[model samples]
Target: MNLSTLTDQIEQRYHTQAEYPWAKFPDYAVFRHQNNRKWFAILMVVEASKIGLLKEEKISVMNVKAKPDEIGSLRMMKGVYPAYHMNKEHWISLNLTEIEEGLLFELLDESFSLTIKKPPQQRLHKIPL
Candidate 1:
């Protein structure tokens, strides 16, 4: 899927907006959890060769969180690759146009769920006010 379409899907599914937080990197957009503000997905356009493709033409790509155990096998998929600028072990880059929508959204869902901030533990005892 393309950038607008991807962002639209995320907004519809999670009710979160795509944020552009970098001044120097205008083309990059980040999608984060609503409560914790932890990033779940990133959309970027980079030179194809930068991501190891043979050409230098700019292509749209997205980075999403992936399970450590599944990273290697996921990379073997047609459109998934090592993360462009994230921790390689916990993230992956997807060629936006090359991946199927179902698989793409699956990854997006996993990424969002994986970043949810667990609530803090309750206090067992309370002192007098």
Candidate 2:
């Protein structure tokens, strides 16, 4: 799927907005949970060679958090690479132009869920008679 379509899916499914945090990289987009402000996914344009491609053409990619064990297997798949600027062990960069729509959404859901913080429990006080 294209960038716009993927972005629409993220906004519609997660009810969150994308933030352009870096002034220098204006095209880069970051999706984060509103409550915690932790990034779930980041979309950026980079040289294809940076992600191991032979050529230096610029390509758009989405970086998402992944479980440690799954990272190895995911790297074996086409279009998935070690995260660009995040922790390589727990995160992965997916070539937006190369992955399937279903897989992309699935990974995005995983990333979104990973960044969510649990709500605090409310405690009730007993009244003295």
Candidate 3:
């Protein structure tokens, strides 16, 4: 699935708008939801490559802190890339190449769920600084 398609699916299912925080980096866009004073379920764009033979790679993968077994079990593929800005051993970079839109959306949902699973820490009471 293409970037637009994948992103569209995410928006539809997640009820969140895509935020392009990295404006200077046009290729990147982050999808997130805000609750109270914090933002969560942040799905950031790491890489995008084209599709087809002569096959410009149009794959986009997100960063994840995968478990040891997850990383250890991932078979290295020819054009596969590891997660960006994430611990290489504990994270994985999923290639969206040749993946169906529905499947991509499902994966994105899983990532979003995992990203937001933990609650934010409570702030300690403090006097004006």
| Top candidate (TM-score) | 1
Per-residue CA lDDT of candidate 1, range 1-107, in tens?
55787788888898899899999998799999888899999999998876688886998999999999999999999889899988999999999868888898899
lDDT of 2 by residue, 43-124 (tens): 9999998788888699999999999999999998888998988899999999988887788888988988888997877888
Q: lDDT, candidate 2, residue 29?
A: 91
Error of 2 at 1 (Å): 2.7
Cα lDDT of all candidates, in order? Answer: 0.89, 0.89, 0.53
lDDT measured at residue 62 in model 2 versus the true structure, 0 to 100: 94
Clash pairs (backbone) in predicted model 3: 49-57, 49-58, 49-59, 50-57, 50-58, 52-55, 66-90
Q: Predictions ranked by TM-score, top down?
A: 1, 2, 3
TM-scores, each model vs. reference: 0.89, 0.88, 0.57
Backbone collision tally, model 2: 0
**Rank by lDDT (best first):** 1, 2, 3
Highest lDDT against the true fold, candidate:
1
**How far off is residue 122 in model 3, in Å?**
14
Off by over 4 Å in 3: 36-59, 64-68, 74-80, 98-103, 117-129
State residue 6's C-alpha deviation in candidate 2, in Å. 1.9
Candidate 2: which pairs clash?
none
Worst 10 residues of 1 by lDDT: 1-10
